[model samples]
Target: MSPTKTSVAELSGNGQLVYGCDYNPEQWDPAVWQEDVRLMKEAGVNLVAVNIFGWAELEPSPGTYSFERLDQVLDLLHANGIGANLGTGTSSTPAWLTTLHPEILPESAAGVRAWPGGRQAWCPSSPRYREYALRLVDEVARRYGTHPGVRLWHVSNELGCHNALCYCDVSAAAFRTWLTARYGTLDALNSAWGTAFWSQRYSAWEQILPPRITVSTNNPTQLLDFHRFSSDELLGYYQAEADVLGKHSSIPVTTNFMVAAHIRNQDYWAWAPHMDIIANDHYLDHRLEDPTVELAFAADATRGLAQGQPWLLMEHSTSAVNWQPRNIAKAPGQMLRNSLTHLARGADGLCFFQWRASVQGSEKFHSAMLPHAGTDSRVWREVKELGHILEKLAGVAGTTVKAEAALVFSWEAWWAYDQESHPSSDVRYMDQVHSLYKALWENGITVDIVAPGSDLSGYKLALVPGLYLVREQESAALADFVGSGGHAVVTYFSGIVDENDTVLTGGYPGAFRDLLGVRSEEFLPMPPGQLLPLDTGATAALWAEALRLEGAEAKASFIEGHLTGTPAVTRNRYGAGNAWYIGTVLDPQALRDVVAGAAAEAGVAVQVTAAGLEVIARSDAEHTYTFLINHSDDEHKYPAPGYELIAGEEVSTAVVIPAGTVRVVRSFSSAPPTTGRISGLKDDESD
Candidate 1:
C-alpha cells in the first residue's frame, strides 16, 4: 500500500500554530459547551483534540454506540472556524467488553491479571481485543472521515505507556511465532541466545514463553528479546488502527509517543515510519534539576525522528501535574518560555494536555489552559498571551532547525546497558549521554540526536556515549563518517558487544578499537563518591578503563591508582579527520574544555558564548531565525544586533534579556555576520 501522504500545514489550520488542548465535552454538561467555545475563541485556539478517552461514553454496551454528544461538539467547533483532531477513542475498552472476555486483560510478570479500574487494561496480543478495537475505529472513521471540520486523525493515545509488557498466555503464543520468523529454526535460536552457557537450550518451539518470575535471574538474551517483542506488539496495534483510518480518511494519522527518558520500552526509531506526523508528549521532572537542557535534548530527538520534518508537540503541561509526589506550579512566564522552546527546535504546532480543569477525577488537580478559577487565574492569563505570540510567529511553521553537531543515541544500546551483570551497576546510560549533551548545550551548541542509521553528512561532530552494543554495519558507518572528514568523540563502554548482547572476542571496545585507537586492559568500576586523579588536574569518578595506545596518542593519564601512568584519554587521526576517546568520566569543566577545543579544531562556531543564554537557529531558503532564550535567573546580554521578530524593533547593540524571557531575531546574511541590522520581517521577504 502507498504511504499516508499529508502536509503538516493542512493539519494545522492552513499553516498557523495549531494552538488547542484535549477537549472532552462529555465530561461537562451541554450548557457548559457555549462557555468552552467562548473561552477557546478568546485564547485563539484553532484546533481541539476531541474524544481521546471516550470509549466508555462512545460504546456503553456491546454493539451499542452513541455519537449524540460528539456530533454536537464537532458542530460547535466547526461553526467557530476551529479544526478538530478527531480521536478514535479506542485507548480504553468499555467495562462490558472486559467483563465479558476477561482474557483480554493483561497479566503481569507475576502471572496476575490487572483489574479493569485503570486505562490500557487490555492485552495488545489478544485476538478478541483487536477485533473489537478495530470495529469501533471503523465506525468513528466512517462517520467523520469526510467532515470539513476534521483536520487530522489521532490514533490511540500514548501507546505502551502503562501496558508495554504482558506475560499472559496470549502474549507467549505471539512471542513464539515472532521468534520462529526471526530465527527460522530452534538451532539458530540456540546459537543466537548462547544457550550452551547454562544448559538452558530449547529443543522445541512450544518450550518458549515470556520471561516470567524465575527463582533468581532470567537469561539476559531472553529478556532482551522480550523487550523487543513487547514493543512490536504495541506497534502492531497502532498499525491496525492506522490502516482502518487510512481506508476512509485522507487526513494525516498520528499517535503521541512518551518520548522521555522515563519511558524506554518503545523504540521510537522503529515507530517513526508508521506515523504520518511524529508527535510526542514530554513532562519535566520536578527534582530541582534544570529542565531546559533536557527539554532541548527531547526536542532535537523528536526532530530527528521526524527525519528533519516539522513534528507536533501533542501534549505538555502548563503547570504542575497532579500525578507527581509534590505538585508545584510553574512560575510566571515559564509557560511562554516552554512553548517557544519547542517551536524554536522544530515543532509546527503547540498543544497542552487539557482544555479545562476537571471537577472530579484522578487528574482534577492537573493544570489546564482554563483552570477551575475561570479566565482570571495566572495559568489562564499566560495561556492567552502565549496563543497571541504563536499567532504572530506563524512564519516559523514550515522551517527547519539547523544543527552542526550530532549525538549517537541507540535504543538497543540503552536496553543492553540496562540489563544486569554489567561492569558497574552505577552506570546509567542516559546519565552519561546527558553529560556530553549538557556540556554542548551549556556551550551554546545546537545538536541533533542521531541514531545508528541517521544521515551523518550534514554534521561536523558526532558524540557517542554509553553505546555498549554496536552492530558491525553501524561500526562501518561511523568509520566512513570520520574518514570522510567528520570529527567523532567516543566514550567508554562503547562497541563492546554485538546485536545479540554477545561480547566481542578480541579485546575491549571491539568494533571501535581501530577507529578510536585504544585498547583496554581491564575495567576499573569504582564505588560512588570515590575520585581518581587525572593529569589535567581533573577528577574521574564512577568508572574508569585502563587503556594502552594502539595507533593513538595519550591526552590524559591516571595519576594514582592500579592503572597509574595509563592512558585515560586518547586521540587518533584518520584519513581526513580525527577521533577522540574518553576512557573515563571527566570533570564538568574538563569535559567542556575538551569538547570546545575539538569543536574549534573542526571549525564549528559557538553562536552564543554566554553561560546562561541559549541560541537556536532555524532557517528557510532565505533567512535564518535566531531564538535567544535566557533560562537562568539572572539577566544576560546578547552581543550582536538584529531585528527582534516579536517586537519588530531594530537592535543595533547589545540587549539585556531578562530571566525566563525569549527574543527571536532574523538574520539575512548567508554567512553569519559579526554585527549587523536584521532587516527582514515581512512574510514574503522572510521566506
Candidate 2:
C-alpha cells in the first residue's frame, strides 16, 4: 500500500463509496504522517477519523489548548485528498481534570470508583465533567468548524461503552430528577413501582437511591428504571455535546454506536433521531457461538436505526481484537468476507478500528488495516484489496438493505431480562434472538432487527424472540400485525411483563394470551442437559411449558416429557394471518424448522437456501446489488443475476464462489431509489 507520492486531486469521494479508518498519528513520529496519507490515497481511502482520544494532547492543562499536532494530521489528510471525520477529543477525561475534580469519576454498582486507566471514566451525569468536556468541544469546533477536509463530526467516541451504569451520588441526584419528570407525582411513582410490597414506598425524592449493592435483591422495577434513567442520562450527555457542536459548526454530527452483542445500555432506537447520520462500531467476537450471524444481526440493527437507510461501519477489527479471551486472528480471505458482509447488510462506509496497528498502549496487540507487520502482511494486502473492492461498490452507497421479515429487537426487553429471577438461568435473551436470526440466515432470509411497536405493514412475517417486556401499545401492534395478515411467532417467556416490569395478571404469557388463543398456568423450565421429545420428532431443551390451547391447534405436542401430550407448539388463526407460539426453547435445528414453517406461511422466499451461503441484496430504484458470501469450506454454485462486480466478469452461467470468499452481482433493478445524502448546515449555520 505504499503511495507513489502522486499529487492527486480529490473532491471528497464525490459520490463514491466511503473508505475510512481510525487514524492515530499521535502514536507515530511526525515524519511518518506524510507516508500515512500517501498510502491512504494509494489504497483508495477517502476518509480518516482523527483526534478520537486527543484530549490530553489538545488541552495539556486547564484553559490551555494546543492543536499543532492535530493541525498537521488534518493538513496532511487534506493534502492527500482525504476527508476528515474530526473527533471531539472528549471520549476520555484527561488525568489533570480528573485529578482536580474526582467527583466526575463514575462509581460501579458496588460503589467502587472506576480509575483513569480505562477510557470513558467520567460519569454521564457529572456537571463538572460536562463543563470541561463541552469546553474542549467548543474550542475544537471553533478551530475546525469549516475545514475543507472535515466532512463529519465524531462526537464522544462509542458513548457509554464503558461507564453506562454509574451508581455515584451525582447519578443518584440525576436519577431522582429524571424520575420526577417521568412519574410526575410521588403517588404515581409509588403506584407504578408497586411499593406496597416490603414497605418500599418512597416518601420524597431525596430518599431514593440507585439500585446499588443491596443486602438482598433490589426491587426489579427500581433496577429497571435505573437502567432506563442511565440510558437517558447518557443520551442527555450526547445531546449537550452535540448542541455545542451545532452552535459552532454546520457539518452533520455523528457518534459511533456500540451496536454489537455485548453492549446493551443505550436504547439506540431512542437515540437514532438525534443524529444526522447513524454510525456504529462493531468488533468480531469470534469467541461467540456464531460470530458471523452476530455480525449480520448487528449490521441490520444499525440499518434499522437509520430506518433502512445506508449507514456507516464506523469501526471494526481487521482481524483480531485484543480484549477477547483467545484473540484468534482471522484466516486468509476472512477479512474480505467480514467487510463485504457489512456492506451487503447496508454499511455504505467501511472502516476499521484503526489505520495503523499500535506499538504502545493496551491495544498494541489489536489488528489494524496496517498491522505491525507493515505493508508486507496479509492484513495490509487485504486492506488495499478491500479499498479497491469498495471503489467498485460506488453504486452501492445510497442503496438500502432489503428484507421481508422484521425481528422484534427491543432494548427495553433486554434491560428487563437482567432480572436475577427468571424461568431458567440458561434462557438468555441473546440465545433466543441469535438462534432465530441464525435460523433465518441459514435459510437465506435476511431480517430487519427492528424495535417493538414499529410499523409491521411492510414485513410479511414478524418473529418475537423473548420479548419479556412490551408496552400496551406495542402489544396492540403485534396483535394488529396478525389481524392485518402478517404471520408472527411468539416464543416462551415473551409478553409476560409490561414496560414497567409489572407482570400481566391473567395468565403466564399475559400480554398475548388472548391473541395467542392459549393460557399457561406454570413455567416448566428444564434442568441442565434435559431434552424433551416432540411427537413431530423435534427436540426441545432448556424450557417446557404447562399449558392448554383455547382455540389454536397443536402443531406439535410433547410425546415423552413431564407434560406429555401437551401442545408444545400451537398455531392460532387470528384474523387475516396466523399466530404461532413455542412453549419451549427448541434446539437450533428444530428452531429452524419452526422458523421456516412460519416463513412459508408468510410466503417469504428464501434466497440462497443453503447452509453457510449468505445472500442479501441492497437495491435502489435503478438496480439491485446482490452479495453472495460463502462462509463454508466448500465452493458454491449460484445462478448469476448479472455481472459480478468484484471479479469483473460477465456471469452468464452460475458463479462459483470458493470457500471463505464473497461475490456480488448487479441483480434486479427498479426496487426503489434510496439515494440521498444528509444536507449540510446552512451558511448561517457555520461557526
Candidate 3:
C-alpha cells in the first residue's frame, strides 16, 4: 500500500482557527451542557478535545459500560457545530481493571511494582494490559468513530510521561525478544555487548536481564540496550493504540510530543510517517528562559520530526501554569504575541491546555480559557480576542515556511552520553546542544533540527554538537554526506562510543578520529572559575581536551592551564568536505567565532543578517514563505526590504518592531540567486 501524503489542505481542511482545548464535562452537571456550548460559540471555538480522562467514567468496572454522560457531551458538541478531536480515553486505566489484573501496573526503574492510581501507570508490555486497553479503544471507536462532531482521532494523552523506564517482568521478556530479533544468537549478543570483560556472557535468553540494577554497574552495553528496549516498549504501546484507532476511523490521528523529551528515543520521529498530523505541547519557565530560545526549540523539534510539515501547537497555557515555582500572569499582550509566533514558525492550529478551569486535581491551578472566577475576567477577554484575531487570519493556516540550514541530533548520541562514565559531571549532552542552537538562532540562522537517519543532501551545513556516540552505520552515512561536499561541525565527546555504548578500543574519538584529524589522550574538566588559553590568543573555560595532531591542524589551544600547549580545536579535510572538532565547552563569544568561520568556509547563506532576529523560509517549486521573528525583548529595526505576510505591508531599513513580534515574508526567487546582494531595493532606498 502507498503511504498517505499529507498536504496543506489535508492538514488544515477543517478550516481556520481550528481552536480547541481539552474539555471534561464529566466534572460538570449535565444541565449546564447547553451553557458550555454557548460559551464555546461565543469564543469562536471550533474544535473540542473530549474524553481525555474518561476511563473511570466510561468503564467503571470489568465488562461494564456507561455512555449516558459521554453521549450527552458528544451530542451537544455536534449540535453546536463544533468539531471534536475525539480521544480514546486509555491514558489511564480504570481502578477496577487494575484491581482485577494487578499485572497491568507498571514497574519502575528501581524494580518496584507500582499500584494503579496516577495516569500512565499501566505496564505497556503486559499482554493483559494490551488486551484490556485495545478492547476499550475498540469499544470507544465503534461508538464514536463516525460521530458527526469527530474530526480527528487522539490516540492517547501525553504518552511516556509517567513510568517511562519500566523494567517489569513483561518488559524483560519483550526485551529478550527484541534482542533476539536484533542479534541472531547468544554469541552475537555477547560479542555486541562485549560481555567477555566482566565474565557476563549470556549462555541463554533467560540469562539476559533488563538493565535495572546489575546492568548499570556491570556493563554499559546492557544498560544501553535497556534504554533502547524501554523506548521501544513505549513505542509499541503507542503503535498498538494507533493500529486499533486506524482500523475503525479514517480521520487523522496524533499524540502530543514533549519538547526535548528524553525518555523516548526519537521514537516520535519514526512514528511521524504513520500519523495524519503531528502535535506537541510547549511549556517553559518564562522567568529563566528567553522566549525566543524556547519557541525556536519547540518549532524546530516539530518541524524536524514532521520533515517541514506544519504541526499543531496542541497545548499552551492561556495565562500561567501552576507548576512553576512562581506562577506569574503573562504580561499584557505576551500571550497574543506568542500565539502569532507559533503561526509564523509553521503551526497550523492553536489550542490551549484547557477550555474550562479545573476545580480538582494536579492541574486545577493551571490557567484556562474561562478562569474559575467566571467569564468577565481579563484572561477570558484576552482569550476571546485571540480567538477573534485567529478567526480573521484563518486563511494563513496550513501555509509552509522555508528554512536554510539544519542541525543533526542523534538518539544514539543521547544514549552514548547517558551510558558513558563521563570524564566530568558537567559535560551535559542536551545543554551543549541547546547552547549551539541558541547561538544559531541569535545569529538569524534558520535551522532544521534533524535525526541521524534523515537525508543530509538538502542542507549546506550540518552541525552535530556533542555527538558522543556514532553508530557504525551512521559513520558510513556521515562519511557519504561529507564525501559529497557537505560541511559538518562536531564537538568534544563525539565519536567516543558505538551503537552498544561500548567505547571504541583504538582512541578517544574512534571511527571519526581520522575524519576529525586529532587523537586525544586525555580530557580535563575545567573547574569553576578556571580558564584555558587558546592558540588563537583567546581564553576558554568549562572543559578542555589535550590532543596530538594526526592530520588536522590546530585551530585553538589552552594558554593558562597546566596543559597550556594542547590543541583546543582542530579541523581535518576528508573527501570533498571538511570536519571541525571543538575540544572544549568554550564561552559564547568563542563558539560564535568558530561557528561563523565554519559557515563562511561552507559558503552557507542565511535569510537575515540581524542579531536576535530569526528568519526561516519554506518553499516548493513556485514560491517561498519566510518567517522573521524578533526574539529579544528590545525593539529592533530591519535593514532590508521585505514584504510581510501577516501585516500585508512592506518593510525597509528603519522599520520598527516591538519585542516578541513576528513578520512572515514571501519571495519568488530560487536558491542563492541573490546570495551576496540584498534583493530588490537597498534598505536606505526603499519605495
RMSD of 2: 7.8
Residue-wise C-alpha lDDT for candidate 2, range 1-687, written one tens digit per residue: 111111111213587678889999989999998888888887888989999999999999999999998988888888778999899999998899989998999999899998887899999999999999999999999999988889888998999888899999999999999999999999999988999999999999999999999888889999899988998898999899899988888888889999988899999888898888888999887768989889989998888888887788889988999998899899999889988988888887888889989999999999998889999989889999998898887788777777788999988898888589777788888888888888888766778888899889999999999999999899899999999999999999999998878999878688999889999999888788988888888888888878899999999888884688998899999999999998998878788888889988998865333456777778877788878888888766676547899888877656667788988888557543211111112223211
Model 3 TM-score, all chains together: 0.91
Write candidate 1's Cα lDDT for 470-544 as tens digits.
889998888888889988888889999888888897778789999988888788889999999988898888888
> Who is ahead in TM-score, 2 or 3?
2
lDDT of model 3 at residue 417? 78
Error of 3 at 16 (Å): 3.6
Clashes of 3: 10
In model 2, what lDDT does residue 661 have? 90
lDDT of 3 by residue, 354-399 (tens): 9889899888999988889789898889888778767656656555
Each model's backbone clash number: 0, 2, 10
- For model 2, how many clashes? 2
Q: Can you list the residue pairs that collide in candidate 3?
A: 401-617, 401-618, 402-617, 402-618, 403-617, 533-558, 533-559, 534-557, 535-557, 645-664
